[model samples]
Target: MESKRVLITGAAGFLGSHLCDLFIKKGYEVVGMDNLITGDLSNIAHLFKLKNFEFYNHDVSKFVHISGKLDYILHFASPASPIDYLKIPIQTLKVGSLGIHNLLGLAKSKNARILIASTSEVYGDPSVNPQPESYWGNVNPVGPRGVYDEAKRFQEAITMAYHTFHGLETRIVRIFNTYGPRMRLNDGRVLPAFIGQALRGEDLTIFGDGSQTRSFCYVEDLIEGIYKLLLSDYAFPVNIGNPDEITIGQFAEEIIELTGTDQKVVYKDLPQDDPKQRRPDILKAKELLNWEPKITRAEGLKLTYEYFKSLTKEQLEKIDHKDFSEFTR
Candidate 1:
């Protein structure tokens, strides 16, 4: 059988790089594209030596032009981190709206199936407990995080439009909080925040009593779920995340244990519009993809700690003091 040609946007990112690695291992020809906006090339630098892997330093928001018979296009572009999207708010919106449009066009031209990396943020400060796909989100349009949340919402709308109007093969996966090795330490997300602080012997900052709950999916599990969705016949959006829930304070404690740090926990003002509770109802993923996260939080956190510990002193410092101001538009 001929090898499938796969194109992945944001190919150098935490999740994107992992997807690229998986595709290459599956005997597929992989093409990766990124602008180095929030994604670091170092994440996938090793893949350049692979015969079936290719990298392109291009931003998808402008225009995407690719050759060869493309079988699949995974649009995982856009700045996902709070610190990132806040810094490049315009780019975040552009990538979700225009970038997705461009990729859908390419998918139509190449007759390739397209999968978009949407987010659980679509359920902005969600009122639902375990959010189901049927729940219409309650997002703030003019809030600080609106740029990213609304962009993802718009991306999903446009994807479905292309699927129905143009008859293009499209898949949307609403990814929840995902963490693993290669995640940018300065991304301002909770997992890295806790881990970085603990590693550096800094006080772990908890916002709003650290009562907010979240479900974290390991990168490997997330990648597998995405792969299954792309190949599956389901058209509607499916949630892909570990249903295991943890409070922010508990998560901080876990990091402290892993890092063996004696640093104390510090309470800080919660960011505006922070969700009180966020977890996915993965019944669809379980029934359709026959997938559940195999790696428990303990196991996943240990693996992540090993990766973070391997970084140089300078790299460790970079993760210690991350600036989140840039994440806003």
Candidate 2:
């Protein structure tokens, strides 16, 4: 009997690699693909020896080629971090537009159920607290962060188009701030950035006076929700995240306690269009998917800090970053 096959884009990334492990555990033959533009190979390198897992070093914004049957497709290829997206804004837009189109075409060709990884950035700086899936969003299409924000907005728009126009099988999960192992320490995300500074014996830099709030979901909790959403019949975007929200200043303090760091938070000017508050309203997710995050913040933070602690001195000292100036044109 042939096993079911799943295709995962951005398989080398923190989230996508974790999805690969979950699907493989569920008896699927996993086909992993990444451009490595923002994903790290080390995240998925452990699966190289598995007979059922295969990988391709191909960028999805270009032509995507895959052989054989594919039952599912998870499109997660994009410069997700602010640093990466801001550095290569063009690529970020391309992946959300061109990359998604390519994967949707492939899904149609293979008759596979497709899931697109959307983000809370689609909400931009929301007027509502705990944003619901129905909100139209308040976004600055011309802001510095617009490249990534508008790209994701377009991704969701087009994805819904495919669902309504072509009647394609699809799922969308608008993930919130997720933290766990395999996350790059220098990605400029709040968790890793704070932890990196502490580990480097520097003050924890908090942009925007550290009052802006964000809700975080553990990677495993997010993966579980996504997996269930993929198998379910829901077609619209679903919000999957921990509802336990905290202010950046408060979170920095938590990290200090967790890592046993003596450093304190330092404020800086917030970047343009940075969301002042973001926490997903998961009621729809609750009623529809029968899912909610089970991991407590304390437990999750302890686990994440341990993972950061496990890195070598060099890896901890500096994280991988790319020079995309040559390709941005």
Candidate 3:
């Protein structure tokens, strides 16, 4: 029998690369795609030699063409971090808009199940603590973070449209903060930024008073949730993340202790529209997907620190102190 095939966009990225690994391990013919804009090839370099794994250096915002039968498509091609989306807002908007359009059409044509990576950012600076999937969100479409936020919001809308009007098989996972190996040290997210600063013997930078709250779900547990959601007969968005929330000030202190670096926490002006509180109400995910994070923050942090510490000195030197703005998932 022929193996199933999956097309994972942004496969060179941290999460996308891990998804590629999962599908390949399941004996699927994995077709990975990325334009290498913010994604690093090294993340998926180990899979290049596998017969079941192939890749295309292409952007989903443009035309996407794949040969042969495709059973699944995981759309994860957008610029995720604030540093990335802020730098290339146009491209960021394009992927969440044009990119998902192409993938959805392709999924329809191929009769493939499609899963999109929506985000907690969709609930922009959420008013309610522990945001649920039903919240309409409080977003500033013209704000600096709007490019990424609105794009994801639109992605979810269009995805639901396809599922309703066209009878497409669709799954949406609103990912919360996730940290692990393969994360770019300078991606500008709070976790890596704090770790990078600590590793460099520099003060950990926190925008605002460091009182804003965030919940982190380790990458491995996140991947399991995604995998289960893909196979489940669900069509609505599900929140997948750890709900053990912590304040930024508290998290910075935790990082300092974990890294064993003599760096103190420093504060700066928070960027406009940065959420003061962000956490997910994941009851839906638990009831629907039967999933919750298995890794504790302490265990996950130790593993993540070891990965960052194992980086070559050259890799470590590439990290420079900058604004450590937190993008909650």
Candidate 4:
């Protein structure tokens, strides 16, 4: 039997790289693509040696072209972190808009199933405790985080349109706070920022009073959920994340214990539009895909901490001090 072929955008990113690994493990011929803007080539360096893996150094926002038949396409090409989107706001918008449009058309032409990588930020500062897919969301289009949030919102809309109007096979996964190996230390996310600070023997910085809550799903668990969703017949957006919620302050303390380093928590002003509470109501995912995170925060954090510790002192120092007033809380 011939192997399935999958084209994954953002192939060098944290999540995209993992998805590539998963598909390759499942006997799929993987064609990885990335612009290398926020993506690091080091993440997918090991895959280059495999016979079934091929990579393209191209941006999807311009035009996407895939030779031969394609069985699947996973669109994960975007600046996900606040540090990234705030720095390159225009590119973020373009990828969510033009990039997705190009890929949907490509999927249509190849008659392939395409899955989009959406974010929990779509439920901006959500009023509900555990956000479900039915929530319309409260987003400020002109806010600082608007560029990325609105871009994802547009991605979801166009994807569904392609499903209904063009009859394209599309799957949307609204990813929550996911953490694991290969994560950038200075990406301005709470997990990496806290871990990087603890590694550097610096104080952990909390943007708010520490009342804000977030649920984190491990990378392996998230990748499994994504794969299951792709193969399932359902097409609507589904949330994939751990439901075990913890406040930013409480999480900081947990980091201190995990790192075995004594660090004080420092408070700062919270960024505008930063979600105060972020826990996914994964009932749909559970009932539909039979998916829920199996790895505990303790287990995942230990593995991640070890990965960070293995880095050289130079790598630790690379976590430079930048203005994190707009962190992805």
* lDDT top scorer: 4
lDDT of 4 by residue, 3-102 (tens): 9999999999999999999999999999999988877787899999999999999989989888999999999999899988998788899999999999
RMSD of each: 2.0, 1.2, 3.5, 3.2
Number of backbone collisions per candidate? 6, 0, 0, 0
Give the clashing residue pairs of candidate 3, or none: none
Using lDDT as the measure, name the better of candidate 1 and candidate 3: 3
TM-score of 3: 0.96
lDDT of 1 by residue, 1-329 (tens): 88999999999888999999999888999999998777777789899998899899998988899988999999999889887777778888999899999999999999999999999999999888899999999999899899999999999999999999999999999999999998877578999888877766789888899899999988999999999999999889999999899999998888888888789999989898888989999999999989788999999999988999899998766544445354434
lDDT of 4 at 226: 99
lDDT of each: 0.89, 0.91, 0.91, 0.93
- Candidate 2 positional error at 143, Å: 0.5
Q: List runs of model 4 lying over 4 Å from the truth.
A: 316-329
TM-scores for candidates 1 onward, in order: 0.96, 0.97, 0.96, 0.96
Worst 10-residue lDDT window, candidate 1: 320-329
lDDT of candidate 3 over 31-63, digit per residue (tens): 999988877787899999998999999989988
How does model 2 score by TM-score? Answer: 0.97
